[model samples]
Target: MKSLPRLSPTSYALLGLLARGPATAYELNNIMQTSMLRVFWPRADSHIYSEPKKLLSHGLVSEEKEKVKGRDRTNFTITAAGRDALAAWLAEPDAATHRNQAEFMLKVILAEGGSPDDIKATLARALETTRTETRMAIAGIQHIIDSPEAGVRKGMPWNGMAANLMADILIARLRWAEYATEAAAAVPDDSDRAAKEDIGLAAYQRALQRLQAELDP
Candidate 1:
């Protein structure tokens, strides 16, 4: 009946993963690298290691220490309170925001002095990376959606829905990356703000349309 303390989204991510089962920080990192990283790209391993302790302090999760190959390992499991809190958070509107602001701003700043060719190369690499990550994410999500256990989870279709959304977002990102690759080449060395804005706006509108189509009810 107590109100859950407002915590960072990272805390809920840890709790949600633990709701499935107990996991050491290492295992959580592996899970993130495999799946969660597609959705929450910027979290570091250090944050994973530290977050469970915060949840434990709040009585949302409990931890136990074990000896693993002569070293100590701490594994965390969600408490009932954690499950309740996670459910409550999920029912609220998602507060997650895109992580591209600083990178995009830096690109704009660098366009003032950096060579167009260099910028093109950077976006080219990003496009390739997005392609690779999106492919892997689709495969992973499809695997989950195909699994029989997916329906038996408490969250059921929402987990499947979230996976579907991730795939859609990645596809949208791929579109934007492709557009960015072309626009980077077209950008003039003078850093024409209007031209850059036009390029970005076009890419954004395309991506938004794709996402909106997926979420249309």
Candidate 2:
């Protein structure tokens, strides 16, 4: 199998959104929040401004100025290159590996300050979020599967495959959350040890932030 070119997940997501029609950055953000938040890329206002510029630089998308409510705004449309990129990504056999462990790690770090009640509350919230997200992902995928238009796509399976992948990820994460909640509940509350651990973690976090600033600046 040929290896695909490296593109951040956000890039492909923006391309996919543009495939539907031209849209301003604000509109894309709204669409993401309303419809794609559970099923697609992680939501960030940074991506709203950044990803399109990257796509535009790569010749995958084009921008036009339009007037809306007396102010000129830029609208982005997918180029042929963009569409091709999106289609290729959709059809690609290999699934991208995700780096999603940071969220779990963040919770571990924050456990330093959490009381037993706080832990229980946090666990309950985590479980609820996992369940709700999984449910939404499943429903979103099923909607596509049941839609008459979805069957007629050049490769119907491929179209559904992306949504299915999301559903699978959500389900897997839900299971992980269930396990994590039980394990967390079993741990004895040790605030002193947690505080010591947090001191180390805080140093590491500061170093990481410095590195991030250096890299991005």
Candidate 3:
């Protein structure tokens, strides 16, 4: 649809925001954390601020100068070029399979001998997040199935598929979290029994650091 380079998902999400309405950085941050971005791309605020510049440089989005309460706030708007680029990206065939990186699992594996209560807290928080995400994902599936364009073959079903997949993943995660929570709560602080279950957390952290170091350098 448009002559455009491959952009990261961060770039697409940013463009999608401007595709809807002109928004300041704060508004973009809210959208990223609250909507589709929350369900998929969990990114930093600084990254969000930097992407508009990249999009603007590529001539895919434009910025409007706006002032709020006497403070200069630049509101970004996606251009026709951006819409075209997004359409092309979506229309393009992407058969490449992606890998999963479960950072939370890494953290959980590393939480050996730390406070069991703290471990419980972490799992509980994850449980709540998983529940919320799964609910939103189900809603997305409903949206896709109800679309008038549902019968046609295109990129729309991908979101519905991903959303369903995420729902399943979240459900599995919640089940794991329950067992993890129970395990953490059941551990005796005076004993190193859990540590003996497998590789102690100290050993795991040391290995993690070495891996991190190797990757960093």
Better of 1 and 2 by lDDT: 1
Ranking by lDDT: 1, 3, 2
Best by lDDT: 1
- List candidate 2 stretches off by more than 4 Å: 1-9, 31-40, 57-59, 67-73, 80-95, 101-105, 109-114, 149-155, 186-217
lDDT of 1 by residue, 165-216 (tens): 7777778778877877776667666757897788778868987998899899
Model 2 clash pairs? none
The C-alpha TM-scores of every prediction are 0.73, 0.59, 0.62
* Residue 158 lDDT in candidate 3: 61
**Model 3 regions more than 4 Å off:** 1-3, 95-103, 112-167, 185-217
What clash pairs does model 1 have? none
C-alpha lDDT score of every prediction, in listed order:
0.75, 0.71, 0.72
Q: How far out, in Å, is residue 40 in model 2?
A: 5.9
TM-score of candidate 3 against the unseen true structure:
0.62
Candidate 3 least-lDDT 10 residues = 150-159
